[model samples]
Target chain A: MLKENKKELESDVIQLVPQLTLDCVIFGFHDSSLKVLLLKWKGTEFYSLAGGTVRQSESLDKAAERVLMERTGLDKIFLRQFHTFGNVERYDREKIKKMLAHLIDPDLWYERAISVGYYALVDYMKVFPNPDALSDACEWWDLNEVPALLFDHEEILEKALHALRLELSFQPIGLNLLPEKFTMPDMMRMYEAILNKKIDPRNFQKKILKSGIVIKLNEVKRGVAHKSPFLYKFDPEKYEEVLREGGLFFI
Target chain B: MLKENKKELESDVIQLVPQLTLDCVIFGFHDSSLKVLLLKWKGTEFYSLAGGTVRQSESLDKAAERVLMERTGLDKIFLRQFHTFGNVERYDREKIKKMLAHLIDPDLWYERAISVGYYALVDYMKVFPNPDALSDACEWWDLNEVPALLFDHEEILEKALHALRLELSFQPIGLNLLPEKFTMPDMMRMYEAILNKKIDPRNFQKKILKSGIVIKLNEVKRGVAHKSPFLYKFDPEKYEEVLREGGLFFI
Candidate 1:
């Protein structure tokens, strides 16, 4: 069955658009740190974001969505195309040939291919990482511990993070990375993780309340040894309204 | 010479990457209105942004730079890749076939092509718009007066403009769309044009002055019937430092 699948993969390559691909940087938050989804290549030290090719009949966005679903077992999340990497130097023909020798024809069309970079924000607790055919393991890695990636993926990852950070500066996008019910401290920690720095606790709370995207709920969080903190869920209508009226950020 | 060049173009198409292209929305500001550069197809009322195909040896950024230089006769400006458009519905086979029937073979490889969108901020006075081989004229059109564009270009243009506006909401990008020396009123008008609304004059002055991206000059305007406004220029070092520090916007 493996042999037959490999043979079918060679024939299926013809249906993909030549010289165009998509790579997704899936970001999730957990344990007070921003994490990124990565896949470990089978029997190799290399890791990379889940990527796929665009089919002749599908849109680029759909291809990215399909790739995200195949790897994380999650869909309908916040995904955005941040940038496209197409430097001639990014195509290391000999290295790629060696890396995929067991999987692909190797003579396959990988010369100067362009990859559109997309960044996705998913709930940490909901994701179930699944490896692709060429990878042995797929899981979340803290941003600080991310190893050197394959191809131009490291640069792509940096750019994706930078774009996400820039958006966070003016927009309340941290809500996407947190659970529906979270504390103000949870929100501030999410922002600090993405920004890679510390923000004033007093300032964050004051400004966030003034922004009015979050509301104070009547219930407190359960299962806490210390004094339980108040639980808060995003006011969806207020959040959407603030987004439309030129977003206000606390950080 | 024209016939020979046409013959060369037919074979040269093979050098271009199949199913990938680029379109640039070159924006300029003049006379209190925001303008976009467009090309009118030869002997037809159809209009489109200056665009080109990527070559096998070049990066996407390099391809966009080449296309921008070809049309605007200007280089070293602020150019950015904003988004990539790849909808299956965007490809109108019959329309493109009829439009380029005189230029290329009927069986060209344009089925479901993906176009990377770029937006350029250029000085209005520096541009020398030149028509491409298939275009009769290239000129600037006011954003309000832009005609129905060819292909999915209208949607692409709108997206580029929206991206620029979103950036403006968080960053002081208006400097790129203005001249080297300008007055406070001139800067305010530039902002109003791009935002497509009026900003309170006193509030704009107070916020922009506090932002410190611009330096007030001692000299006043030379030609004016009423009181002449003082001229000012951007402080490059301060502007760049603010950008590096995640930008401070007045709008």
Candidate 2:
């Protein structure tokens, strides 16, 4: 394992895109709460989004997918590149420098560091988070309760959340966060959770139904405090068509 | 002048962001056609988007502004980061290597090169396009008729156009492209050019009016074949409010 880990960090890695890193902010919705997958470094109190150096021969998109799969053991997910953070100071602060000293020379790292932030919206319950060799534990942190993250990761996470919220306002990305089949109320709860606000139930229902991207499933909520809501599933074909036609317009 | 240029390339230039570059896709609406800023390499048939290497200390946004000002002699333009091109092959082709050999060691350049793509919507007549030290000319090529561009610039241009068109469909970014006081027909023409499709004048007028983002300027077109259309300007306060609320909702 020690040899394997050292080989992974070797300089002769084919087509390695040096001084470049990829960070994934995997957002998931579970138990009516919005959460993000985070990894804590081994034997340290510091935490960060799963990050990987880009391989030289791979496109940023492919690199992002590789990193996501390596960290969470999940693939074929839609990973959106929200922003590339290029502030040279991102790894220059003394505390962050100390946190990263073992992994990279802070002086050289700060000289050429730029990170592309990619985000994935996944069903939290389905994902099996796996930490990389450097970290021992990976878990989901509630969007509202993330701890102090290492380096410039907290800012990256904030921007990822902002990008996700902006897209959710219009794009039907909840398909990535929700289960295959869920009650309409569950769908509504997820949206409310992401938006961090309560929406008018009647208006929300009417708008979604009018959008025609969701199909009524032949099921209902089995156990609930209130009357069970009708089950719904996203119509992939209609969803793509609607998304192409500027997505679901949320007013 | 040669000595001055040599000194500019020296390593002593403070705060240079090594291995990182900024490329701008300056989109301008002109003669009812959407266009982009392109720079032709000096003594070569090759053309590329105006690009600049990043200085180490300044933020990416500031570097983008600096590059835009150096290329177009325009300042205070709102340039949006659309994508980051980190493909190792972005400058790996033989022809591109030769074209850029004098500027960078192609081997080293290919190893760590990553470019941040930015797009700006500016009035066509407002910019005075200027070539950099390596280019002989800078001009706007019609988005439909752009010649073969150098490096992966063509891909960058396409993505920028796609981003611009997508945002134009919903966002009131026309605030940047249109003159302060313009007629309804002028605004409609700009939209038609961007969408590459004719819009029904009546429906377009109705929608813009309903958005409540533009304020009538109490003026009319001076001379036109049709009856002079009412002139208007984006209502600053209302425009900001609408933009903050996620811009015009064009269905």
Best lDDT among the predictions, by candidate number: 1
- What tens digits encode model 2's per-residue C-alpha lDDT throughout A1-251? 12344555555645456567888999899989999998988778889899987766678889999988887778888789999987767764777667766664555443456789999988788798998877878999998899988878989998897787777767776777888888777888998888888988889888888888899988887788888888899999888886666566663
State the lDDT of candidate 2 residue by residue for B155-232, as single tens digits.
898888777776676677687788888888888889888888898988988888888889997788777888888889
lDDT for model 2 comes to 0.80
lDDT scores of the candidates, listed in order? 0.84, 0.80
TM-score of every candidate:
0.92, 0.87
Off by over 4 Å in 2: A1-16, A98-109, A225-228, A243-245, B1-18, B98-109, B200-203, B206-212
Which runs in model 1 stand beyond 4 Å of their true positions? A1-14, A99-105, A174-176, A243-245, B1-14, B99-106, B174-176
List of chain A TM-scores, every candidate: 0.91, 0.91
Clashing pairs in 1: none
What clash count goes with each model? 0, 10
The count of backbone overlaps in candidate 2 is 10
